[model samples]
Structure formats: C-alpha cells, structure tokens
Target: MNNADLRQVVHANSGTTCQELAEMFSVSHETIRLHLHQLGKTWKLSKWSHMN
Candidate 1:
C-alpha cells in the first residue's frame, strides 16, 4: 500500500503490533515500524498489545 493508505490503517488500528501490521501489509516488521514513524506515530508496547 501507499504511505497515505498505510497511515490510515495505522490510525484505524492504533493498537496493532508491528508484526501484525507487517503481515497485514505484506511487509516486514521493520517496514511497518518505519511507516509508523513516518506517520508521526511509534509502536509501543502500551499502544500495541497482544490482548488487542
């Protein structure tokens, strides 16, 4: 997906893990992490939980 699309997905699923988002986007966990950062957001344990 594009950067804008990635940002929307991140915003919609704020509690999603990097690994999870990676799978959803068919990208690497690091790639998702980068996108999150690019979107002015960072994936944290509190923001991204396995429970969610």
Candidate 2:
C-alpha cells in the first residue's frame, strides 16, 4: 500500500506511459520507475502491464 496515490494513478490509467506519470507527478521518469519497482510492478510492451 505504499505510494497509494501513484498506485491508484497507475490502476486508473493502466495505459499511462512512464513519462506521463512523471509529468503528472511533477517528477522524473526515473523516479516513476523507481516507485514502480518498489511497488513490485514493471513496464512491458510500452505500458505498465505487470502489477502486484
């Protein structure tokens, strides 16, 4: 349940790109990647398709 806001955003927009998430959160894409990694998720096929 960490980063719940980010997780909700990801779930709401399953097709959102990393760059988009970064823009939305006013952070770097690398930060988004790190959060996703911490959340046990991953990017695949141009989307954050893997979730946990």
Instruction: Estimate the TM-score of every prediction.
Output: 0.73, 0.81
Candidate 1 residue-wise lDDT, 5-49, digit = tens? 877776677777778888988999888777666667754665732
Q: Per-residue CA lDDT of candidate 2, range 1-52, in tens?
A: 2479999999887789888988999999899889988888887766676665
Best by lDDT: 2
**RMSD values, in order shown:** 5.3, 2.7
lDDT of 2: 0.83
lDDT of 2 at 8: 97
